[model samples]
Target: MHTEIQSMHLRASQKQLTLHTGVYYTGMDDEAHTFCTVSDSLQHSPSAIWAYLTPVLDRIKAEVSDVDTINFYSDGPATQYRQKGNFYLFNKEMADRNMKQATWNFHETSHGIGVPDGVGGSLKRTENMSVLHGKDITTATDFVKTVKTPDSKIRIFQVTEEDVKSKIIEKLKLQPIPGTMKIHQILSVKRGELWYRDLSYNSMEVHEHQGQHLKFFSFWKVIMLYSICSLH
Candidate 1:
C-alpha cells in the first residue's frame, strides 16, 4: 500500500536564511522498539559478575553509599552474587555470549533482585542518556514501524544482524567496523523467559580493551560511570 503522508510541522531557528528541520523522531523512540534478535553486549564479560555490574554500583553509590566490603560470590548468604559496598551486581555474561550485536548492556544493577532466589525481576527501561549511542536509538525510532517481524507479538525487530549491521555502517559513515563493542543498560524483563536471554540494554559506551580481561573491567567501568551519570 502506498500513500503520500502529510508533511510534518517543523520548528526552526532564524539565525540564517536556510531553515532547520525539526529534530527528527524523539517521542516515538521513547517508546519501546525491538532490535530484532536481542543479545547481551557483554557475552564474553569476565567470569566475575560483579566486575560486569560495576557501572550500576557506581551509579547507585551516592544514594546507597555506605559499604566497606564489596565482594563477588557472596559469603555466608549467597554464593552466586557479588557486591560493591552494599549494592549487588548479577553475573550473566556467558549465559548470553553473542555480544556482537550489543552496543550497551549495563542496565542490570538497579534492575536485579537479591540473588538466584531473589532474581525476581530485571528492569528493561532505565537508561543512561549521556553514554547511549544516539544512532541505535535513532535506528530504533526510524524503523519502529518497519521493525515488525514474523513474530512481532513479543515485540521483536525481525530485522537480522545483517540488516542492522549494514545500516550502522552506513549511518555512522565508518571506514571499517573498528572491531569494538559498546556497553548498554537494560531496563525491562519478561520474567521466566530464559534468564540470560531476557536481559536487555539501557545505556551505551564503547570499549577498546583486550578480550581476555575486557569483560571484567568493562563491567566495573560502567558501574562507576553509572553513578556519575545518574547524579547528573
Candidate 2:
C-alpha cells in the first residue's frame, strides 16, 4: 500500500509516515500472515527496508520454525527493493538468519497485483475509519496501537528512529550491480553468493566470475560469469 501518513484526515496537516506491508504464506495451513511495519522515518532505502523487515522475519521464524528457504515476490523499485544494497542485504540477512536458500522475483507493473495490496488497502480503510471516529493517531506509534485488535489478523511492528540511526546506512559500502534494472530474479544458495538473471528460466545458462573477495558473498554470479566484489 501507499505510505500511510499521520493525520490521515484531509483537513489536518499530514506528516509522511511509511507503512510497509508483507503477506506471508507458509503453505502448511490456510492461514495467511499480514505483517505491517510502521516507521517515522521517511526513508525508503535498503537500510530502512531492513529496519522494517527484520522484525517481520523474526515473527515469521518464531512461528514457522521448520522452514528454511524463502521466496520474495514484489514489484521492482530501484531505491527501495531492487538495488545493490538490497541484494547485499538479501544474501547477508538470509545467512545471518540461517536460511538455506532464497529467491527474489520481480514482477512487472501489470502483473504485480497480489494479496499484499489487499492487506494494505484494508488497513488504510481501517485507519481512515479510526480517524473518522475521532480516534487520535498522530504518530506511527499511535497508528500501530489504533489498528491492533486482539482478533485482528494483521501483525504490527514498529521501527523507531533509533532503529534507523543504528543501521549505519552510510557505512554499508554498497556498489551498484550491473544490469540491475534488467534483473528480474535473484537467487542465493549460500552465504555471500547470488545468481541473477533478466528472466526466470530453469534451462537458462549461467556464468561465474573469479578473483576478489566480498563482505557477505565471496562472489556474485550472473547468467555468464561470477564476479567478485567486497563490502563490509
Candidate 3:
C-alpha cells in the first residue's frame, strides 16, 4: 500500500484553480480511492500533503480494520513524504490507530510507476473530458460535484486552507541520520523501532525512537559495527 499526490489544474471561464489530488491503494485490493483538495496556491509541502492525507487515512483505517500492518510506497520526494515531519506525524498516527507496524518504501528516482499513477491519470482524464463537455469546475466543491458519480469508487475530499493549518503536529521533531540520504528504499517505523535499508534491500540499520526523537547514537553504533565487519 502507498500514497501519491499530484497537482491538477481546473478552469472555468477565465479563472484557474489548483487541485491537490491524492490516490491511496494496495496492489492486493481491487478497489482504490482518490482524494482531492482545492487550493488557490500550488504549494505541496510536507505539512500540506499530510493535511490532505489525514482524512484519507482515516477512511482507510475504517475500511481495513483487520489489517494490522500498513505499508506505504511513495516516490523519493524529501519535502513531501520522506521528510522527518511527515515521519513523526505518521508514527503518531500509527500508534493512535493501533497498527502493529508501518513501513514506507520509496521507489528509485524516475521509476515510481504503480497503481496510484494510473488512478491519478484516470482522474485528470475524467476531469479533462468533463471540462471539455462544459462542466463548471471553478471551485474545489464544484470539481468534486462534477466528478463524483453514484457508481464511482473514487472518494473525493475538498480540503481548505484552515484544514491544513489545523492538522499540523507541532510536538514531534525528527533528527536526520548521518551518512544516509533522505530517500531510502525502505523505512520501517514501528512503535519504538526504526529500520532503514538501501535500494537493494540489503544491509539495514535500526534505531530506537526515544520520546519525540530518534536515538541517533544507536544508528551510529550500527554504522561503526558494519564498518568494522567490512574491514575484517
Candidate 4:
C-alpha cells in the first residue's frame, strides 16, 4: 500500500483555488487500483490527510481480507504522515482491524517515486485537457463530474472544512522519541510499542509500552506546567 498527497490549482469563474488530493495504490495481484479524494483547501495537514485516508484504507481492508500484514510506503514529509500523531492513528487503525503488523517505510527525500506520481500526473493531465477544451471546472463538484473515465478506478470526493477538521486525532501525551528528526528509513509501531531506526543508528530501538507510558506522564506534567504559566 502506498499513498501520496498532492495539490492542484483549479480555475473557476476566473478565480484560482486550491484542491488537495490524496492518492492510494496497492500493487498486488498484478492489478493496481487507485483511490483518491480532492478537497478545496491547501491545509493538507496531518489531520486532513487522515480524514481522506481512513475510509480508503477501510475499503482496501474489506477487499483484501486474507492479508494479515500491511506495509505503507510514503515520502517523508513532517507535516503529513511522517509524524508521531499519524503514527498513533495508524496503530489504532491496525488494532481496530486486528492486523498482525503494519510497517511504514519512508523513501529518502528527493528519491521518492512510483505509482502515486503516475496516478496524480494522469489525473492532472486529464483535468488539464478538459480545461483546454473549454470545460469549466470551477468547483469541487465540477471537477469530479468532468474527470470521469470508463475504466478508471479513481474515486474522487469533495471534502469540506468541517469534514477535514473532524478527522483530527486526539493529541497523544507521549514525548518525542529520541533522534526521530534523524530518522530516514523505517518507523514501525506495533500494538502500542514503538521501534525506529535513523540514518546514524545501526540498530533499531524497541521501546516498551510501559516505559513509553511513564515518559508520557512526565511529558504531560511539563505541558501542564507550561499551561499554568500561560494562565498567569
Candidate 5:
C-alpha cells in the first residue's frame, strides 16, 4: 500500500486526506479485495503504514483462517516500508499474529505501477463523482463514511491520528539495518529470522552470504551495534 493525498472539494472545509490503498490477492480463492484507510495524518512513517495496515491484516486473517503465509508487493521507499523499522515490525508482528511466514517484495524504483495504483485512482474518481453529486467529504472520517456502503466494492476504514501515535509508541526503539536500500525482498520464515537479497532470484548473493544469513536482531542488540558503528 502507498500513501496518496486525496483532495475533497467540500462546500466548507475542502481539506486533503491521506488515502492508504491496498489490493489483496488470494490465489486459492482467486479473488481480489481492495481496502483503504483514510487518515488525516499525512505522515507516511513506518508507524503510520502499520496503523493503516493493521485493520486490513486483521480482516484478511478473519476471512481466511487457513492463511499461514503472506506476500506483500510495494514500492521501496526508505521512509516507508523499505527501511529497518518496518523490517523489525514485519518480523515481530507476523509471529505475534501466529502467521507462519511472510515475504515483502519491493518493486524497483519508478516501476511500481500496478493494481494498487488503480485502486487509488478508482477511489479518487469515486470521491470526485460523489462531490459532483453534491456530497461533502470534509474530513477523513467523512471520507470513510461517505465512500463505504453496504455494497461498496472497496472496504474503507478510518485511522485516527491517535492510532498512528500509539503505533509510534509501540515501536519506538529501532535500529537501522545496513544495506536496506539494496534489498528487494525480505522473507521471514522463523520467529527471529529475516532473509533478504538484492533480487529475489539472485541465489548467488544468498549463497555468498553463507546460506540463511540475516538473523533477526532484537532492538536493544541492534542499538548496541549501531552505537559501535557510529563510534567508528
Candidate 6:
C-alpha cells in the first residue's frame, strides 16, 4: 500500500533559519500526485529528500549563512517534515518529463555535469562517474531499480539467508565466496521497501527520519560488507 499523503507545512517563527528545497518521485504515479519533502537544522532521512537537495544544499550552504530555518510549500498535498529551524519546498510540475528529471537534479548536476557550450552553431556535454557502468548507483532511486532488471532476470526475488549460500550463487552462476555463507542474513531483500535492511534492525542508517520509526548495498560493496559481516 502507498503511504498517505499529508498537507504542506512551513516551519514557524524562527530567526536565522536556512531553507533548502528538493523534489522526489518516491514512485508516486503522476505529477499531480502529492510530493514529499524534508529539511533539517542538520540532515534527516528515509533519505528520499537527499535524492536532489542534499548536494545542492551542500553547495548553497557554502554561500548562504544567515538562514537558520526553511519555509516549505508544495504544489499539492504531501506527507513531509518541517521543523522550527529549517525550510523546504516542492513544486508540482505540469508535465511528466520535467517532473521526472526534477527528481534527479542532484545526480544530473553533480554527475551528469551537462550544459550547453557556446560555439559555431554547436553545443557540448560531459559526464563523469567513470566507475559506474551506464548509470548511477549512488541514488537509491536508481540503484533500487538495478536488481529489479538483471541481464538475465526480470522478477525481483526476496532472497532469504538460506538462499545466500545456494540460491543466489547458483542462479547468478557464481561460486560462493569461501566465508560468505551468512551474507544473506545481513541483507533483507529489497522487496517493497524504503530500502533494504541488514540483519540488524539498525541495518539501514536513517537517523530519526521519523519520530517513532523508520529505512542500498552495491554489488562489490555488497560482497565486501557481507564477506566481513560473515566473519562475525
Best by TM-score: 5
TM-score against native, each model: 0.19, 0.79, 0.68, 0.69, 0.80, 0.18
lDDT of 5 at 31: 80
Query: What lDDT tens digits, residue by residue, belong to model 2 across residues 21-115?
Result: 88888846778888889988888887788888989888878888877988888899988888887888888889888887788888875885678
- Give the runs in model 4 whose Cα sits over 4 Å from its true position: 1-28, 170-174, 185-191, 199-232
lDDT of candidate 3 over 52-131, digit per residue (tens): 77777777877776766777767767777766666656666676777766766777779856666666677779877886
Among the numbered candidates, top lDDT falls to 5
Worst 10 residues of 5 by lDDT: 1-10
Error of 6 at 66 (Å): 3.2
lDDT of 4 by residue, 144-212 (tens): 787665667776656666777886755535445565555543433355654555432223444443322
lDDT of 1 by residue, 1-232 (tens): 0122333213252111110010111222443221222222212111222233333344334433443222122222122221121111122321132122222233333454333222111112211221133322223333333333365432332222233232221121111112222222221111111111122322223233332122222233445565676779
Model 3 TM-score, all chains together: 0.68
By TM-score, rank the candidates, best first: 5, 2, 4, 3, 1, 6
Sorting all predicted structures by lDDT, with the top scorer first, yields: 5, 2, 3, 4, 1, 6
Return the lDDT, model 6, position 200. Answer: 22
Off by over 4 Å in 5: 1-14, 169-173, 201-220, 223-232
What is the alpha-carbon lDDT of model 1 when measured against the actual structure? 0.25
C-alpha lDDT of residue 111 in model 6: 37
Error of 5 at 62 (Å): 0.7
List clash counts for every candidate, in order: 28, 8, 1, 0, 0, 12
TM-score between model 5 and native: 0.80
Tens-place lDDT digits, model 5, residues 136-170: 77689778877788888998989899989877734
For candidate 4, what is the TM-score? Answer: 0.69
**Model 3, C-alpha of 187: deviation from truth (Å):** 4.5
